[model samples]
Target chain A: MRINLASIHVDDQEKALRFYTDVLGFLPKNDVPMGEHRWLTVVSPEEPDGVELVLEPDDHPAVRPYTEALVADGIPFTSFAVADVHAEFDRLKGLGVTFTQEPTVMGPVTTAVLDDTCGNLIQIAAMEAPAS
Target chain B: MGDVFKALADPTRRAILDELQERNGQTLFELCTRLISKHGLSSSRQAVSQHLDVLEAAGLVHTRREGRYKFHDLDTSPLRTITDRWQLPTD
Candidate 1:
């Protein structure tokens, strides 16, 4: 019933690992060998037990067209929930992460989109804290 | 095309995936029935088929033909990749 795992198909695992960890600050969770491709995963250091993001290889026949079309249309592959989108945006920008959309406020939520450098655009979003 | 995010982004598609996960192997008719009865989804056969095609492209689903019946199964390896990447402290 509870959700735990999610995946992001990357063009290259090693390169994706570097961007996800070095730039995004996610902690490496798993790195099991799977022949040519290793079974890899990463966790947000802030929420270690929250959920795992899989860094999968985009070797499947259907993946390329799927990713390319989205990229061409300027769509984010998936979004991550953040405590503060603005702060995370600034922090990530400082680390040379390229952003497609700057922090934007829309009623109850704030969001920003960035390129993962692994052939996908990712979004970071946050909800406004309710007033007491 | 099998965009994992695009495949997963839709509520109906997610429901279809859930159906396959709960029951490993099911024919198209069975899936359509369960989706309507259990999830109250009112999509047409064509719509469900299209969604299944999307999921298949995303590698979330696998299919095989046995005799006259084609059955669908949730591969689940892709799901594991997501969770495995963000592993627990057991490492």
Candidate 2:
């Protein structure tokens, strides 16, 4: 089976769309009206057909507690691969993004965690080549 | 002071302090990541958190709540108790 879709629970769909597209630079892929909410999704501009990220609603009673606990502990809900973690961290910070963890080298990877503003923390990471 | 020595008895707790020394303010997630990746610690997140509690009790680590996020910071003042009790002789 191929993995074509991934999802994150966002507090607000409208706000999530703006952040995913305008702030984080993802392209809109799908938007279907579904009762009180919409089936909203976005794809990376670089890989339009690679994978779709669903902006799922966090209206369920359990979602708030789950997300809040993770946020309180500075745990990210999910991670996105980036070309350069430091560059992305700087760029996001320029746009008023709040980071829970700064760009730090962890063995073979460099990572940073940022607040998505939709009730979840997202991690950005880049793999570094091991020294010979 | 006894609590300080008891807390320092664990290797994982000391590793947490070392990582905090490298970067003063860190989240539990960051500390756990550093311990697993850099120090080869296989402890779970909950275990690391309990270690943090021990450090906090010893006054070697301080936890701060900034808005919705909580951060851990290293504090070495407790170590001074050791120096205050025993003085080194000068040549």
Candidate 3:
């Protein structure tokens, strides 16, 4: 049917929580203790009931290699929609965020990629209106 | 110098050089995105990577690793070989 949940494998749950909430400005949606790791998720404040992002753990053997391979080639694990990619890139850079790719115009979209610090590269993008 | 000519023969490789010229340093992902979006190149990532290898062999592109990420940069010094072989007449 419709998508309600999306997920990203983070190396540490606590660090991910802090980065997602304090830095990236996502609100905590769920945090239930499930043995050693908790079912942690965060939602955009603007869309509280929208898709929740699960901060899954990267404890599995395959996850490290998978994430590392993607990072080595500068590929982003997932992309998030933003209103203005250049403005967000500037704001995030002010807060000590490292961007692998600066805001670049790619046809109808402007995009930037940043290191999440949890073993993943996240892309932020914004659509531009067509030229008259 | 022959390798340079061979490398420059491909349209995709030239496009890669153009993007690198626009922005000196770029990851393979950024190059791929530019090629597909700006140049309408339908080449796969692996294919684009192979093209990069060709460029590197010709000394037109150089790849550097900064920590965990790898970036591709353009170096046009090799193109001087052409000028060295042939000189233009002044009026």
Candidate 4:
């Protein structure tokens, strides 16, 4: 099954916006006001033109604790795929991004873990070879 | 919480599954060292085994015994159920 988009609630919408758009290179897809907070989203530059990442505010009871726990532990809410994880890591590094983990080979894939610099650890990975 | 979503929710678990997706069978220690080490936190072999148990219970992953080690792999069949829940707008 395919996931169209993955979303996580943020404590500060504006910070989340800048991090996702400016730092990660995702394009802002929508910003709609929905009560106390707005429904903001960003889509990947490369896509089959599928799901956008929804930057939601962590105010709802169902979402607040989950987001908080992930942040406290530096665990990313989700990860996105890349064609070349090593190149992506280097490119982001040149842009002044700090990575928590460099790209390393793991079985049949090469993966890298990085700090989103926004209270999350985002992973970038590329498929290496077909499974045996 | 529902098992499948719970299995998919955590980034570490997701990474482990992603690794397995590319290489269908992997030892818990290999997954732990590759996926969890970057976070500066390492899950023990027992903990990884437990996570595998949780995934197996959720029907999100499958395990096979190879020699003395158990290899874990992604089982995307349950994801079809998750996909069915989301209805895309044709209009």
Q: For model 2, what is the alpha-carbon lDDT of residue B67?
A: 92
Where model 4 places Cα greater than 4 Å from the true spot, the runs are A1-3, A60-74, A129-132, B1-91
- lDDT, residue B59, model 3: 94
State every prediction's TM-score relative to the real structure. 0.57, 0.96, 0.96, 0.54
Candidate 2: global Cα-lDDT?
0.94
Per-residue accuracy of model 3 over B11-74 as CA lDDT, tens digit each: 9999999999999889999999999999999999999999999999999999999988999999
For residue A113, give model 2's deviation from the true position in Å.
0.4
Best by lDDT: 3
Report the lDDT of model 2 for residue B87.
Answer: 65
Per-residue C-alpha lDDT of model 2 across residues B25-86, encoded as one tens digit per residue: 89889998999899999999999999999999999999999999999999999998877889
Better of 2 and 4 by TM-score: 2
Worst 10 residues of 1 chain B by lDDT: B63-72
For all predictions, the C-alpha RMSD in Å is: 19.3, 1.5, 1.5, 17.7
| lDDT of each candidate versus the true structure | 0.80, 0.94, 0.94, 0.70
- In terms of DockQ, which candidate is stronger, 3 or 4? 3
Candidate 4 A-chain TM-score: 0.79
What is every candidate's C-alpha DockQ against the true complex, given to 2 decimals? 0.02, 0.89, 0.90, 0.03
Proportion of native contacts found in each model? 0.00, 0.84, 0.91, 0.03
Clashing pairs in 4: A4-A51
**Ranked candidates (DockQ, high to low):** 3, 2, 4, 1
Candidate 4, A6: how far from true, in Å? 2.1
Per-residue alpha-carbon lDDT of candidate 4 for residues B16-91, written as tens digits (9 for 90 to 100): 7776776665545446766654444467756766777778888877777643235577888888777689966778
Instruction: Report candidate 3's fraction of native contacts.
Output: 0.91
The residue-by-residue lDDT of candidate 1 on B1-91, one tens digit each, is: 3667788899999998887777676656556656776778899977988998988998988877643235688976666655677876775
Task: Indicate the residue-level lDDT of A77 in model 3.
Answer: 98
